[model samples]
Target: MHGRIRTWGPGALVLLPTVLLLGYFVYGLIAWTFNTSLTDKHNARPVPTNHVGFENYVNLFGEERFLNSLKNLGVLTVAFIVGTLIFGLIWALLLEKGVPGEGIFRSVFLFPMAVSMIASGVVWGWLLNPSQGDDARGLNRLFSILHLNFLENPWWTGGSRWTTMASIALPAVWQLSGYIMALFLAGFRGIPPELREAARVDGASEFKLYRYVLFPQLSPIALSALIILGHMSLKLFDLIYAITGPNQFRTEVPSVYMWNTLLRSDMAKAAAIAIVLLAVVAVLVIPYVAYTVRQENEE
Candidate 1:
């Protein structure tokens, strides 16, 4: 016992504060939110003594607005993840070939990520403004100037709700694609040159080399990026809110809906939405975390 304490005592003491803080602020709040969701509490009855037991969740899933939000979330996730991965991979590929001014290009690509999502959303909000005719501005004006009028459309305010949500994902893709590029680029560089040489010696072409040799090794990095982006999509809020505002059902996600619900003092409903979002993020993240831990242990 004395020997174990001597070895582990300082590390345990150092970790104690962080463990307590995380337990209370993070996990504890999650528990409190879950408890609140199991209640009949709102502005009318601020006290949550009435334990409803998942009634809020049941009603939330049945609501048309919430269902639409989930649909929108699905559309945004698919678009955002696909767009970012494709673009990031392209950028990384170009950089990996030793392009001129690689450092400058990499920084330029990554600069958008340094800007906050809200700022990017505000700028993109103007760029993707649905207005046309005499009131045309932003991309509409640019389209007119370039005579690319065919490219101009109502963007996120389009009639099709799923299309609108997918369009809203463009800004998110722009902001995060660079980070994905960095991930892929790091993965590419971490690969041993011997692997490439050996593949070439085996008569593999450039395309075949990447398709069979490089990409397979990058699978772990891609999976990690997918999980990270998946959770971000699940909790998406600030960008959508900044672009379309809270009332736009076409682009509304659960996080924005939760905020709006909270504003109306619908505490139970909002907590239910938050818990649902948390559960979704966990579903994406936890599996990846387990896989990572298992890989670490095997190594």
Candidate 2:
């Protein structure tokens, strides 16, 4: 007991300041937000006598823009997750087959993730710009060259909300799929070679082997990836803001809406929206995390 305590002493002392700082920064911010959400106070003026009890939440639910933003968030989250997972799995499989120039391919895929989302958004925005030229020197040009004229619609300028949403989702997928692929590749590599060889020797088809043998092993990693991607989709802000600006109805995600409300002096509404967003993520993520932990313990 004495030796163990001595061994931990230095580590505990080192971690004390870090723990305190994290609590002050993270827990402190959350508590402050909770307090502000309950009040009807503006930045310049304090509403000392006007303590609104969930009035802001009621008002927030009544707003059409808030409702629309929530809908968009749902759409974005689902599409982003599905798209990234599918693409990531495909990328991982391709890489696993020992392709030539594997390093270059991996780097190319991950380079987008290394770039800031804001910068990627700006670049994508330019590439999708509708008013470029008659040749439509962006997405339009590429579509025209490929004889896919239907896809040449002015994604940025046109009033087609779905088109705009798809455009935004494309860049997000490009940036995120690489990270997902890395996770899946690591999971795939951890599988025993003997198991795969034995499956093949037993006349199991490649597809069957992957489905029955490999997928179950990957569940924990996949679940973790899902939780992370879901949280990211829930609080997505930088990309949307950079690509569509804060005021645009077509690209207003929940986070963007919350920002607008907070910056525009609707503190109560902002806080209400923020709380709702947090609750949504918690509902989706908490169960999965608990399940993962339980599975880990069982294993």
Candidate 3:
């Protein structure tokens, strides 16, 4: 016992404080937020120290803004995830053709991924500005020049609910599709050349080869992208805030709602929003984590 303790003691001593800090600061913070959500501790509540027990959640769900934000999130999540995956898969497949300037093309595609979403939002917000009068700018100018003025519409601001959400998704897809492309590309390249040759040897056509062999191999990559992008879309904030500036337009998402709620000192409602968002993220993440662990175990 003494010898074993001596051997492992230093590592335990090093890990203990860090683990305790994380448990308190991170997990404890989450627990506190959950507790806060159960209270009526802000704004005009008479007894501020009382636990209201989900009244905040009931009030939050009844709000039109909250419902709209949820709808907007759904739109953004679908558009962003579908667009990124399809475009990314397309880019990956095209690059897998061993085209000339492969490195340059790959770098060009991936460069946007390195750009911050806030920066992307700023640039896209300018480019897709809907104003066509004296403030005619970016794509509106080009559209006017090309006589395609009909295509010029509100980009990320003030539009049909779904339209605005889809507009915001465009920049998101543009920025992150490259990363998804990289993921799929790596998955594609990881497939052995022998598998392709054998498929060909068996009289498999190119489409058949890919449909039967290649796609199944990319399932893990697809799952990873789906989970990553889904969580991101659910938690989207910085980009929307940067571009939209708390306008509460059709593009407003949950994170923006939470921010505005907190600003109004509706602590309980804001915490409820946060907790709901966290639950959503958890719904995505926990499954992914379980799948990953299961994969590792099977391996």
Candidate 4:
């Protein structure tokens, strides 16, 4: 025991502050938020008092707006993940093939990631503006000039709810596709060139080589990206807020709902919504973390 303490004591001391800070600020806040969700607190008194159990959560589920937010989240998550992965993989494959201006193109693809989500939202909001006739602007104006007026229509402001959510997802995909491309490109580069040669020598066509060998090797990278994107989608807020603002129910998500609920002094309901978001993120992330840890241990 003495020998063990002598070896580890200094390291433990050095990590103590960081551990305490995480304990208080991270897990501690999660516990506090969960506790608040179980109470009957309101804006006038944001503190928890009457223990109402899961009443707030029950009521949260009953709310039409909350249900709609969940549906919007589902639509956004599917569109964002599928669109990003497809586009990212395509970019990675094109880059791997040694296209001309490869270095410049890679930098151009990644530039959007340098811009903030709010900025992308503002820009896309204008591009997708649905105005027409004399009032037309953005894409509508461009389409009018090109005489392809049929392509222009109301984006998030006036559209089918699912389509609106998917439209909102486009900006997110544009922002993150480059990062995903880098992940995929790194995965491709990490595989030994000999694997490609072996597959080619075995009479495999180029498409078959990628389909049978390279793509399978990228499963780990894909899973990691899926988890990351899934969690981000579940907690999405800022971009939607910047584009649709708080009133656009078609684009409303749980985070936005929580903000609106909190503003209305419904503290318990907002806490409940927050806890729901946290639970969803945990559901997506915990499995990936476990899979990663198990793989590390096996290796």
Clashing pairs in 2: none
Q: Name every residue pair that clashes in candidate 4.
A: none
Over 4 Å off, model 1? 44-48, 133-135
Sort every candidate by TM-score, greatest first.
1, 4, 3, 2
Per-residue lDDT of candidate 3, residues 128-207 (tens digit): 78888556788888888888888787676666766788888988999999999999999999999999999999999999
Model 2 lDDT per residue over 1-299, tens place: 99998999999999999889988997787767766677786554654636788877787789888888888788788888888999998999899787999888888888889989999888888788775345577777888788877777777456555666667788899999999999998999999999999999999999999999999999888988898989998888899888888798877988998888788787766777778887898899889878878888999
Candidate 4 segments whose C-alpha is farther than 4 A from its true place:
46-48
Q: lDDT per prediction?
A: 0.90, 0.83, 0.89, 0.90
- TM of each candidate vs. truth: 0.96, 0.90, 0.93, 0.96
The true-versus-predicted C-alpha distance at residue 231 of model 2, in Å, is: 1.0
Model 2 clash number: 0
Q: What is candidate 1's lDDT per residue for 24-126, written digit by digit as tens?
A: 9999999999998988887766453689898998998899999998888888898989999999999999999999999999999999999988888889998
Worst 10 residues of 2 by lDDT: 41-50
In model 1, what are the clashing residue pairs, if there are any? none
Report residue 17 deviation for candidate 2 (angstroms).
2.6
